[model samples]
Target chain A: MNLRDFRNFTIRDYQDLFAKGELVPRELLTIFLERIREVDSLLHAFLFVNEDRAFARAQKLEEEGRDRSVCPPLWGIPIAIKDNICTLGIPTTCASRILEGYIPPYNATVIERLEAAGAIILGKTNMDEFAMGSSTENSAYGPTRNPFDLERVPGGSSGGSAAALASLEAPLALGSDTGGSVRQPAAFCGIVGLRPTYGRVSRYGLVSFASSLDQIGPMARTVEDTITLFEIISGRDERDSTCAPYPPFSRAEIPQEEEVRKMIIGLPREYFSEGVDSRIVGTIEEVLKGLEKEGLTIREVSLPHTSYALEAYYIVAPSEASSNLARYDGVLYGLREGGEGTLQDMYFRTRTSGFGAEVKRRILLGTYSLSSGYYDAYYLKGMKVRTLVRQDFERAFQECHLLITPVSPVFPFFLGERTKNPYEMYLADVFTIPSAMAGIPALSLNCGYVDNLPVGLQIIAGPFQEGVLFGLALFLEQMLSLPLPLPEIGQQRRS
Target chain B: MPGHVSLEEVRKIAQLAKLSFSEEELTRFFQDISDIIAHFEKLNELDLEDVSPTSHISWSQPPMNPDEPVDWQGSDLVLKHAPCAAGRYFIVPKVVEKEEKLS
Candidate 1:
């Protein structure tokens, strides 16, 4: 098989590629390097690419793992880390000017897990500044263009990771989701992305966006591949007190009920809102019909307080962001002042010169919202609404097993479409945030395409129910047969 | 009523947040803050007298493990991209200094 076939092979298919003696890790690394050289001008998905380092690692893996039980799970498996996540040797710019040359001295917990599994680290992928915007347009490095349409966005914060996976530039990648960063981008880029129950993956080295809300999750071409990667990286680490101890079902224990009568799905009415695109809604309805034809039960349930999730999220997220981001002063970390001035002058120059306008806007809003005098009214009040949102899901789960919704309101829009209107752009996350707010496992998988562009169906379950979530995602794959292709915009330049 | 915040209060908060803006930008920020609080005011109408307020969803403060200082002390070559280091520690200029406020 040549490089085209090499790029297309999933992690599962690679074992055979290795067994056949026709392809090896070094050759695969060269293919990805060559592909990036061709297509990355249009994609702009990566902040850095390390061909020599990646090739060296792959060569070491081939030499060491050749004949020993010392075989590593991801030995030579290529992975791209979202820029916000730190690697000891590589820069960890959160795609903001403040951290233009900043690098962490240690690996994030997720990166440690990936390297332990022997995955090859290719380079840093672009993301929204401090995991902030919905379009990735907020990156100081510039936005990552969707491989499906170079003129469109890859759907942000995690957009670079999603695009890299979609274009087969990497078999697996890492991204962080505070609200919908992981799922929405994966949906737009047409790949499978999992936002595990908050804290399922450790945030030990993740630069804090919202301390309570930030989570690291996996993006992949297939659901089983996502599960496989999630399993390898998940477990309680003493380093992260927030990490939850839970596991998705392994490949060996995948359930096949022998018939259709055993399956059940719940469609919450709040998810089918007024402004959602009719085509996106129609695609999900078609999937529901197909599931029904297979003998599964479908019920329309009410998450009575669903409308309040987004409102609550904006307040709480910014409030926490306001506090967590205060650490990036000119003194301790990140960009510093270059000229002689007062301490105050140094700080003023450093911050004003450092952070982007959107990030500055959030910090100001958040700090004000959480200040002593307003805490009870705004910050504390938003938390009350947050509880009601979680209880609404808990109450709904009592009635149904799985909840479904469109991952975003519409398909991928042109890159600069709604960025000038941040409010309108924030709306893309409305459907996906409540689950994150409630700390539940959610998955986004392609359901159908509109104008040949992909739309995703999200599967959500109660906290720690990732096994159920993965099962539903795999089941949807078995049931949907349309040609929902990966991001194909850069294919001409890729080979 | 947003009795806790005013235009002057927004300026103070922006200073704490480390963002410097012109007088015009400050006015715009105050207006937006007022609008957001006005929307949040709708929640105050609810009779939530007996409801409990939540601080966090699933967070537990990290338990302190063995308290030995793990050595970050390395030029270590691992932190090659960070430009601000002196020996084993990350170096930064001093933070607070006496200042005069404008009258």
Candidate 2:
């Protein structure tokens, strides 16, 4: 096997070559490191690249002369991790100045599983500060530009991971999705991202945003690779109480094609409301017609409380964020600023200077919502709306096997377009936020292109229903069969 | 826009969040935050008095792990990330200073 462009290689491609003795782990690692050095400066995808560690790991694996047949599934394949997920001995900055030099003493459980599967940790990618913003512009390290169009923003907070994959910096990546962080970025970059059911992937090491909504899952160039990583990282962990007790997920668990084809796809009418771009709706409608022609049924469904999802999400996420982020008070970990007199003064100054604008905005919003006079009105009301949102999904699923919607209402916008308008940024998450509130499994696949930018079609399933989600994604992957070409970083126009 | 939050309220909220902002920033935040809260007011249109708030969607009681102690190997490593640490303890400014002598 002659590997021409290593960036084009998928997990299976690399595995096949390794098993055939035509390729080795060390050579693959070298290619990626070289690729990162060449392209990453333009993308700003990675915050820290562990050149020495990755090379050493690869050399060690090669020296072992390990039998490929008996090794872990991801043996020798390199994967990037979002900066928020902790990596032992590596700084997990969450793209914030507060954690500039902070390093984790232990790895997140998902990291442990990835290592056990023999996947190489390439490096940590940039994100919205503490995963608070729609675009990665909020990142303290500066924004990760879209590889497809240098002038536009890559939908974030997982923008770096998606950009990395789009640029062929890494074959696979892991990112946390709290209200479309993973899926939105994936859509913008023309890759695949899955947010497993909450508790499906252990959250033990993920830095919390909103504890209830945060979930870490896989991002890759293909459905097969996403499922492969998902199956490996999923399962219960003692450290995270919220981790579900479900048995380990596997390839054998996916529903058969016939069963998947028989499934009814629901198009939530609320998701197709007025502000959504006509081009996006046009693309989704075309895909729906194709799916119907393929013997699958499509039906109009109503998720009545959908309009309130954003409101509820804003309240709950920031409320929890305000509570969770209170831990970074110049005490145990992260940055510390001096106080003139009191410990409280240190906390005030440290947090004020350390956090970025979006982060501070959310913190204030959260703190106000959960504060004494407003808790009952804002936070509690948001919680009730959350219940209504979940109920809406519950009712919708009763009529259909799964739900399909646009990942974002519009295509990737130009960088700085929505930076000044916070409301506009929040609206980007409208369609994806409901499923997140419901704590269901959702996957984004590159369905079509609006102009030169790729448009993603999201498929959401009931809790612990990743198997069905994967099956539907696989069917769509085969049916669409669209060639996803790598984006030229310099080009910012229609292809 | 019915209930406009004043600058004083914004200050109180910032204080609650352990954050401090410049006067100009506070003014801008007040407007931005008010607009956001006005959007959130859409929730008041629905009658959800009977609805039980859901903190999480899962109904299953999480299975608790055995209460046995496990060895922790990262104490020193964790301390290494602290901005100021004396041995394993994190150092902070004095919270309670000597009472000022009566002037």
Candidate 3:
């Protein structure tokens, strides 16, 4: 198959070809690598591409040969990984100068699982430095542009993974969502992303941002593909104490249309409030109306504490970050500066030079909040407010099986538009934060497009209810059936 | 709560964070952090007196794994990435001054 045909092929399509002996893994890898060579200069989505390793893996898979019945799932599949997840011997920079050239000696549990399933690692995709920002613009290397429009951001810090999938660089990718990193970017890039329930996946080798909030989620072009990847990487891990004591997700059959019609979806009133763009609200409402027409109930519910979620998140996330990021002390690994000075000076200089502006800002904010005098007032209070936020979701779930909202408040903004204003960037995640704070499963799927930019409809379910979440997503994916053509890149610039 | 984050506070926070900033950057951080803190004060408006803080979402305690020692094969590889190392020990600038005597 040619490049165009390759761009349209999903994981299943490639598997079908492999089964028919019409394609080899190495041939597919070459096509994707060639596309990356031609397109990545414009997108800057990858920090490092494992070309040699990928080819070796693909050739090995070819030699092993595909067995129709016994071959592992995801065999010969090329997948992109967000830079934060550790892959042994590969540089996991988290798109920060601090970790430049620091190759991990161990693989994250997800990486081990993916490789065990016969998936090939494409490379490490770019992200905000330490996953702090909502835009990839904060990346120390560079930003990953939106596939739909080169001038706009592919909402971040998982922007690269989303952009790669949207641009057809890879069919499956992994991203860590501390806040809206995965879902917002997925929405902006017109792909599928999920933030599974906390503890649903192991966090053993994934770099920590916020201990309570960070989760490695799967991203793909379709909900089914996303589900396939999610099942592979999720389940209990002894290494991660936080991982729930549950088996890997069993493939629950997607509920039939009749059963789906019986389920009720709640629309949080706060998500559709004044701050959200009217176009986005309208686009999601139209989808809700269509669902309503299909004999599904769409009830308006209240998440009163939603207004305080962003504030609490800013406090809790940064506080955890300041504590988690203290390991970079110019000694063990990563960049070091001013070696001849005192240990304190070496630490100060290394951190000051290695960290970018946003990272330092968060570190300082967290330090101040967790410092002796302010802990109760800031960090403690933030946690209390988080409880309120979770309660709001619990109450809403009592009235409905699922909740739907816009993934982001507005369309993907142009590059450098919100870079100067940190608060403005924080507002972009307003819709995704409440669900994240509650630690529930949330998925972003393309529901419609406005002004030529894709609008995402977010479906949130109670903890461990990812099966239900995927069912709704699959139903909507069929209903919308929006043809996601390969983006024309530079050709579609706004005149 | 408004305009309460002073330059001294920003400096202290930076020091505690082990990060440094120029005079100009310090001024900018003061303004930015003050604005952000002011926004955070909005949370105080709600009465959360009875609500317990949620440090983690799951209420169940994590089950512990057996405490067993296992050989780690990556020791050499781990030390290889260190900026300064001497025989498995990471080298660093002196922590204690020469005049300070050990207790």
Residue A311 displacement in candidate 1 (angstroms): 1.1
Which should have the higher TM-score, number 1 or number 3? 3
What is the per-residue lDDT of model 3 for residues A1-495, given as tens digits with 9 covering 90 to 100?
Answer: 867886556678888999998889899888889889989999989999999999999999888888888878899999999999999999999998889999999999999999999999999999999998888999999888998899999999999999999988887899999999999999999999999999999999999999999999999988889989988999999999999988888677457778888999998888888888899999988998889888899999999999899999999999999999999888888999965669999999999999999998898888888988788889999999999999999999999999999999889999999988788889888988988999999999999888779999899999988888888898899888887647876777769
Name the TM-score of chain A in model 3.
0.99
What is the C-alpha lDDT profile of model 1 across A231-294, one tens digit per residue?
8777677787777544433554445544324656789888898889999999999999988887
Better of 2 and 3 by DockQ: 3
- Candidate structures ordered by lDDT, highest first: 3, 2, 1
Q: What does candidate 2's lDDT look like per residue over B2-85, in tens digits?
A: 346677888999987888888999999988888888898899899998999999877345878899999999999988778888
lDDT of 2: 0.89
Q: Which stretches of candidate 1 lie over 4 Å from their true place?
A: A6-8, A67-70, A245-254, A257-261, A484-487, A490-495, B3-6, B28-38, B59-103
Better of 1 and 2 by TM-score: 2
Using lDDT as the yardstick, the better of models 1 and 2 is 2
What's the DockQ of model 3? 0.75
True-vs-predicted CA distance for residue A443, candidate 1, Å: 0.5
Q: Compute the DockQ of candidate 2.
A: 0.73
- Pick by TM-score: which candidate is best? 3
Point to the candidate with the largest lDDT: 3
Deviation from native of the Cα of residue B10 in model 3, angstroms:
1.1
